[model samples]
Target: MQDPNTLCRRAVEYLEEYRDSQRHLRADGVGRSVGDVWKPPPNSIFKLNFDATVFVEAKRTRFGAIIRNDKGAVMAAMSTGGPPMSSSEEAELLAGRKAVEFATDVGFSELVIEGDNRNVMKALSSSLDDRSLLGNVVDDVRHLVYGMHWINFSCIRRGGNRVAHALVQHARNISEDVFWLEDSPPPALNALYQDSLLL
Candidate 1:
């Protein structure tokens, strides 16, 4: 009793699933073929750090991030944004998405995202609550998740994310323009950030 159109759509979805399964199987077979040789693990695991800052009541909202690797070196793509939110939560999600884009564009195999926002991390680590706005963000997050071999989110105390935190605070003073730091922010910002006791 289903509509003919619905049936055709379902059929196409089944075919797509079958194709994906075959592709995965072929990839696994190739890995098995190379099992006898020792291989080093992938090096594309990069660390993504995020933070957000609000200046004035709603005047300035900024989000920032840094992507680093095991060597503690930063990636070329760093960004700070005057994101679309009137609140910190909005900046947090915007920063998170920027991190996701950096990972995808740079072809990282694994991503470890750290943020100073505990609420944002808790929301992402848990199942999406259908009634909450976070559900919408969680839905978009899955798209980035699918591209990674491994993706993990951790909530760190603000003190642990000074580099990213400083970026946001620094951006809060600037105009609508978004800035990418070349040599990192000045020592005063770092000193002020450490003294802020953001932890």
Candidate 2:
């Protein structure tokens, strides 16, 4: 058995090595092609970017989604909360599902769904069924996608999804699902404005 001091040293070394690898990856420009700018969907289609944040101590997860038209106008925004999830992937899956539901509720026939979770995006974009514990959630999202006239699934870097990311963090402060048609939380509005300027 290893002594406590040895274990502590090993943990510190592992963390240092992990940080170094990340720095090297960034410096080498490897495994990172996507830019941080938010891109709009094609003409006539709305883009839905969704994200989630977990609060383990509170045993709750918060989800947020923002819908914008091709012209970079905010169509709608939603923030909701649910039971705590065991993994960020699960939280992301739930956020994607919420985005779909919100789109359907708003009668959007065509759309593009975007998220920062690569695994969740891949599962939803693929034709093959997801057989993991989160399969049910993925299946439901797939069903929603099929119902739409046209739907595209895309993965984005967290930096590019600032508005939705901010909304998710804002969800923790609200009690119920809130929707904004013409207005949004200040942080999200600021993010939207910043992203719009890039268009």
In candidate 2, position 22 carries an lDDT of 65
Q: Per-residue lDDT tens digits of candidate 2, residues 68-183? A: 89888888888889777888888899889988988898888799999999999999999997889999999999888787899889989987899998898888888888888856
* Model 1 lDDT per residue over 1-199, tens place: 9999999999999999998876664452243223222121236677777777766575666766766665554553353555456667767876776667666766676878777678778766666563576667666666777767897777776655767776676666666644343334452354333322221
lDDT of model 1, residue 68: 61
Which candidate leads in TM-score? Answer: 2
Q: Report the Cα lDDT for candidate 2.
A: 0.85
Cα lDDT computed for each candidate against the true fold: 0.62, 0.85
RMSD of each: 20.7, 15.6
* TM-score of each candidate structure, all chains considered together: 0.62, 0.80
Task: In model 1, state the lDDT of residue 29.
Answer: 27
